[model samples]
Target: MQHPLAYRMRPRNLEEVVGQQHLVGPGKIIKRMVQARLLSSMILYGPPGTGKTSIASAIAGSTKYAFRQLNAATDSKKELQIVAEEAKMSGTVVLLLDEIHRLDKTKQDFLLPLLESGEIILIGATTENPYITINPAIRSRTQIFEVYPLTPHDIQTALLRALKDKERGLGNYQVHLTSEALELFTTATAGDLRSSLNGLELAVKSTPSDENQTINIDLKTAEESIQKKTLSADKNGDGHYDVISAFQKSIRGSDTDAALHYLARLLEAGDLKSIIRRLLVTAYEDIGLANPSVCQRTVAACQVADNVGLPEARIPLADVVIELCLSPKSNSGINAIDAALNDIRSGKSGQIPNSLKDTHYKGAQKLQRGQNYHYPHNYPNDWIAQQYLPNQLQGTQYYQPKTNGKYEQALKKTYDRLYQLQNKERGHHDD
Candidate 1:
């Protein structure tokens, strides 16, 4: 029986491997390792179908070392032992352990010594965050490198290679894929070349030949085959957070178009919870104080989006994204809190002043609580120049209010007034 097109199309060497130029490119880390014949156990983490397995195969082929494969979740210990025995016999073996995060204590125990002895070069692949999931024992023994989704151009290059390739690919079939079909085939799979190539194989074999004996595959056929397995956006992968980061940053950068673009991607990924969480955070973290009312509006939009699930949810989300992108941006709110927290964590906080302490109890000035405290309501303008912070952090300033929006401008005026009055009463210069 013939193997799948993806299997047959596995790159035989580094040159054949598509994309991942950061690692496998000229003079890159992986390339350097291959050239020096000094390979180490490594974990490749990224979304599915981004050439994790292909990179392992390419490395083995390039080094002319024996390559083996096993699944950390499915394969038995006996299978691992067999591979270990083969490694002993062959002196060295390149083992691709898929789903390395699922590796149990038992399997890991068996592999650790072998990895130490340099008998097995384990290339563990996973779509999960290895730092969070993998055991420290395994992590300490290996380096972790991240892979990324292939670009549309990279996907197109692989598809064309499959079309012309005869021995491993479907070259014998007289197939004619239109430019539109080719574009859809390369792009719809979301950087998964395996899906596109196999979809091409299916399209070629299933589509009947025309009067000219040429199997014609159009955009419709491409859509059917490729979209059947919509990789369901690996939200747990780094790619998900990357899009969220981009979304928030775009809003922070005031690029409405880029912000909406990333928002569309996140919404399409089907995780309303993550999208909402990111939006709420962006409002306070990035747009803080500058446009205070926008924060409440963001909350309202999020409520609406949460109440009505996706497709329709996109409507409210779009409105919030546009508003946030155009809103005056400030990080003063988050920065002030973070700075105060740092002081608290560093033990700079002193005891609360007795005068400012609680006075609602029945002690009746025995401990002098609230003795000298002046009620702000009794003072003019409902404010008083009193020391609220601890004696140690006397003149510490935390909230550096920004004059980005009208609301914050008004706030800054009041803050400046209070600072001047407080500094004079405390016998300190305005800082």
Candidate 2:
């Protein structure tokens, strides 16, 4: 039976695994667990083809335990029961449940007892975040480890190994791969070693051999095998959050290029809702008060994006993203509100001054409510200093505006002048 190149090239042991040194490297958590033969239930999660299944297989191989593989999406509850029964009979078994995030409550309930009894060392694999998708009972019983994407160098190493190994790889063929071809494979696969190896196999198998009986793979052959880069992003997975975080940070850092790059990625992935939400948050949190108009523009852009959708939607999104990236950054407004909130939460709220209280409804002027209230419009500069905040917080300043942008600079000047006049007025009254 001929297997796929990726399957044939699956790492048989820990030493053969190409990437994820953090888990499989010397003295690491997984390595120690394997060496000590002290395995437990765990979930391996990350973008696909980062060696999650390979790691589970390696652990079982090194420990010489009975290994069983099942897909949570297609496998029936009876199949899980069979595995659990076998674990009970054999003392212990290692079950590799792929797409474990899809495990239903029925199967989860059945496996919980076996997992608790220590008869089955469950090695669940998922591309989604376990915390988000998996049942709480199952998640609480397992430790989660993230498998990162393989680096280009790591993928190259795997490619070369597959080409050189005769038993499980293309070593039987006299193949010559040019550097350009190899670079294309690595670049097009986007750190997914499986895709890279699959493309390499296709190039070698599909290309014709020369008179010398040597299969020559050039850049054109590689391109034909894998035409486009496979983006390592899942809209419902951790990659979604990661890309959004990068996009926001880039805008906050005022890196227009990087911000645009991440925006293009999100657009390519068709993550419209996340993009819209993130743009609004960035406008307020990162660009607040620096250019207040940016927030209004961002909201308008979001509306346009929702109405127009896709291909054309990218325009308004790009406009807002670039505007935010280039705008002066400030968080003074958010900080000021947070400070006020903290004081309220800590019970620092004091009684409102009688002059500022509402006296519109049937007061009859008996309570003297709002009697001495000084309307700012009645004073010069449309500003008058009377007690507005609670008496306990009357003099405490919360909004300390930054002079990062021209708009904020004008505000700072006005704020300082108003307070200066208020202090003078109070001093005169005291005299």
Candidate 3:
């Protein structure tokens, strides 16, 4: 009996691999490496089901070097030793290690000698970022090539082949997939080829056989087999753009649950960078003044992400999310400053009114720049009244403090004193 559609669909050669034409196409660097027998130790880093393993296999088949396989999560140091000895005797060996990041520091140290000796050309495969996950020493020794998710055209081409090919595919099933079904499969899988094909096969098997045997994979069946059709983040398109907009709005609206749900969708769809960017924006723009610390922490998280990269960086982003959501809400101060800026932009260019201008300049003395400019600290409580803006815009309320937290309380006291001084100054002007 044959295996499942996904299992059966594994590419037999580099040519059979879909969606990575840049790496496998004629004149490509990797193809050149394979052809010239000049392939170096390298890492294939990409998301799941993007053919990291298959790419490794293709390299092995095409190259003249002896190929050895191991899983870092399961293979022991003793097994590594055996492989090391084999490669030492074999002259040139291609060691293809899957989930290479799982190898602890000690285990990775075992391979350094062989790699340095030129006995083993290491090929590491990782879904997580190799730069952060793999030992830096090991990563430094190898060329890193990033593999991206398969495009819809690539998936469509593969699916059509599977439905038509007789030898190693499901041509016998004679499944006629509707356009709607194909769309659901592509969107639901989130660029995971194995997932899309598996869902396709399941949709076909579940449909009752009829004369035409036209398998229509409706949304309901797609959802049932896929367990959950988490909406994809449009990493590029308008739909993805809209969803993210809604997600950010939820956060700004203080709808914590809705924000979290949209966050989950982005995360599930592998929209890590975009999620971090939005969180950073919200930390400052939405939660500012109310909890200034939220912005600081969010920016720090972004830095951590930049320094360390994904999988590990994900934790910091998660921390920022919780802190922003649970932080006491306040937008009065944020709105106030924005309103004030609009006033400055729309109004006629105002002068540096004589009362507020600098007194140090020679001409400024004659212009009466310091005529009424009061040094607030010289007066009682460092609370003397003075106009900071142009005379016409005096007492223009820009930042209205919110009473939600300690910051606002401090602002309220400061504002009251400032207002009193402004009124006193106005009375003097009236006199």
Candidate 4:
């Protein structure tokens, strides 16, 4: 009762843990390890409140191993020595080392032997990337797994459980959470379950009970408790993907206003990398062939946006998004390339024509390579009727051009004329 709601609601076993299904789900690596009683040292890295600590605690709980906690930066060698001695006495102990990236060489050297002896199973946790921040010695000794932020659904599950659990949760108090209030708590804290639980506890404790003697947490109370942020969408949340999808679809559908609206949301979220990636993809896939130059300009705009960062970045991003929405749309380039790839993947290719084979070597002429090949530059218009495609795909066509814009229209004309000339030349040979 004295502990924080988050601490009280901590998963006592693996089954009680929320989120990180990839690591804790049935048949997953971690679960398999626990089932077989074969636990190894592992480093779990990801955003805060993503169940890194929960996973470690769950493993220790499930295996009935003694769990010890320590912070690599704050704790001294004496503390580690104490944990090591306990592991020796207990046979096996699960040690959770937080902020592992801050561990200096001195502490690392002391812990390495304990990890190897199988006496202390180290579970290192950090918000930084292990590959870049962690020492190779520690890294090589431990397995690495990335945990993800809790989705709104995952957070909701934990919140509901906390409310109903009479022992560890607020089941003793007759509390009613408005749906709006519940939603605010789940999303407002970005995916930090600890923060969400803390907010829920705050709302429950601060709000006065009504005449019914029941505590009612409304939307306003929830807002004050968690403080609805300017950026409503967490980069890891479903809302983030929704906005990005809307942004790309708006541009593709030629809705300038809608595209701009979604762009503003993403900018507010401060997700510059996602915005840039989506814009470039939209330019190439949606506006391609129709306006080749526009695609080039889009790349430049994305580069500028990346360089400038934020408020100023919004300027170039807005400019390109508007232009992309107003520009003519075509999928012909992507369509054509995919069509060629499909053919090649389906075993449509054949040997290169002898006349078209490379003539870089001395004996290539003896093999009739390039002997009969008509060089396009030697002919009018720098083009000629030649067998360029593999023999089996001699007349196969792939580049289906579009007439959505003047550029593609011109390309279609050129493609059709060349194909006709080549067909006509083949017809003469057939005769």
Candidate 5:
């Protein structure tokens, strides 16, 4: 049985590995480790087709060790024990465990002794972050290295190499790929070399050779082989938080276009809860007092979105997103509260003013709690000159409203007037 082109084109050694120059390049960490023949157990992590498995395979080939492959998702404890026994007999076996994050306690426990004894030189591969998914004991035993996505140029180089290599690749077939077809493969896969190679192979094998004995693959064929790349997202994964962060930042930065783009991505991913939550957070955290009405509108929009889920939910979501993107922004409300909380946390919470203390309880008059308190409603403008904060924080201003929007501007005027009246009263009393 013939293996897939992607498998056949796997880099046999470190030298043939196309991407991840940071790790496998000359004098790099992995290369140096390979050259010194002092290989240690390590975790290789990154996006798919970025050569996590290939790097493990290349390292095994370079060191001339007995290489064993196992999938953590399907392989059982018995299989792991078999690998461990082989490692014990071989003195040192390079075990390439794919989806290493999926390895349960049983398999991990079975491999721990072998790993510690230096019999199994484990090279674990994972698409998820090892720190988050793998056992901490296993993580501590290995040096973690992240293999980034292959660059377009790097992927293109791999494709060309596969096309010309006859032993394992499609060199025997005369395949003519137009520039447009090549672009479709390169750009559409988004730096996934495995997808690119498989698409190329499908394009070549499916199309029959003409009378001239040549297979001409066009742009349409390439697209059909590797459909348009779907946006890489996991609603419960890092991509979820990442997109929401981008959406909020775009709105804060006043970039309507970017905000809409991120919103569209989240909506397409069907993460309605995240969209509604982020919109509410962005409204208060970013728009804040600068445009307080935005908070109300955003809340209403969220209600609408919740009532009518996606497809139609996107309408209200777009409304809120656009309004927020164009709205005046302020962080002062949150900043003021955080500053006050910090002060309180630092043990600066002075006693509440005597007059401001609650007087509804029994024996309140005997304690003289409300003795000097003047009702503001009894005075003009329903306001009175009195200390609302403790003595230590009497004159300390927390909410310094900005004049960015009309609402805050009017608020600033009222706030300034109250302070002015209080200062005048204090001056008169001092005289």
Candidate 6:
């Protein structure tokens, strides 16, 4: 017996394939290719249940070309060779490779000679970003068609047809979908049509068959099946945005424990790489001179993530998040530099003072550029006050070191020495 879901709703033709109208609509690139019989190797990229399989099957059914299917998730290179042998004998072949991203680079490369020789036309399918997941050589030769999420109206129409279409649908059942209940289902499914239909099938199966024949589906039944009530602490979507906002606030407010808790929540939700990246940025931008070593450890965690790649990597990322949160916080350097840059972009372009500009070029000495530039190493204590910035901004201060770390402690003493030199120069001028 056929799977109930597959039996009831497989599209038999291009006209029957729903969504992705951009690719399949009249006179569109893919539609014209199908009609012209000039289709090239391509990859169908999208989330699951967005009709990648259905579109490939429709192409096979509608076109006269020989269609062969291989799943990269299960098939080995040997199995692929068998298909290639058959295709070589045949003049034309359409080889549909599903979950193609799961195949390792070597297995993916096995198709290069065949693709170049025109032994087979390839159609690859994947859910992940093909640029990151596919072999670069294989990717270069194929066209990429993007599938999109189905609209709620399209899903509702499909559900209505499933209820009444006699031969292949649930014609025997009298299913009543309340308006609010339908909206709830649409919202919960997140554009995955297969999950939506499967839930509808289950709801129909579970509803009692009786003389009253009134099947009521409310929000609760829909929620239970889809698990829509669970809250995610992820950072990509709305929940992530909210959670990260709270985490940043905790850090800014100096609540180490609260910041660490939110960081832990993000790590638990499989967002360690992203968490590590943020911590790296925060260490430099927020914890700068206050705790410079925090930046070093955060960068080390990023390297660790590249090395370990998973649940094992989560430990390093979590350690960095906690350490950065507890490290002393300061924004003096961040504020000062940003203020300077903002002035530059907003029509405050400052010229590089002649003293700071390199004077290695021929005849540079004739113009007196770099003529009086101080060599700090030649002076006692290896320090000198010089006009480094533009003449207009000569005395402007941009990097004010914080006092919470060892580097900052040494910086304060140097700053005091520099201040004394400036006052001494002023006193000599008055004399």
| lDDT accuracy of residue 383 in candidate 2 | 76
TM-score of each: 0.92, 0.86, 0.57, 0.63, 0.85, 0.58
Q: How many steric clashes does model 2 contain?
A: 0
Candidate 2 at 340: error in angstroms?
A: 3.0
lDDT of 1 by residue, 133-166 (tens): 9999999999899998798899889988988998
lDDT of 5 by residue, 149-220 (tens): 788789888888998999999999998999999878877775788999999999999999999999999998
* Cα-based lDDT for every prediction: 0.90, 0.88, 0.76, 0.90, 0.87, 0.74
Q: On a 0 to 1 TM-score scale, where does candidate 1 land against the true structure?
A: 0.92
Ranking by lDDT: 4, 1, 2, 5, 3, 6
What is the TM-score ranking, best to worst? 1, 2, 5, 4, 6, 3
* Pairs that clash in candidate 6: 234-240, 235-240
**What TM-score quantifies how close candidate 4 is to the native fold?**
0.63
Task: List residue ranges in candidate 3 displaced over 4 A.
Answer: 64-68, 85-91, 205-208, 211-221, 227-431
- Per-residue alpha-carbon lDDT of candidate 2 for residues 345-427, written as tens digits (9 for 90 to 100): 99999998888889888963798888899988997878777666676775677788898888888988987887777666766
Task: Give the per-residue lDDT digits (tens) of candidate 3, residues 1-431.
Answer: 86888778776567888888889889998889888888788998876777777677777777756777899999899988988888777678878898888888878788888888878888898877676777888888899998877877887788788888778777788666667766767666656788888877887788777678665567677767764344553465434665688877887776778877777777766777888788877776677777887778888888897688766776776667777877766777558867977887898347876776677767987776678666778888876655667667766677777776677678789887778778788779769
Leading candidate by TM-score: 1
lDDT of model number 5: 0.87
Give the residue spans of candidate 2 off by over 4 A: 208-212, 227-232, 293-323, 343-370, 419-431
Candidate no. 3 TM-score: 0.57
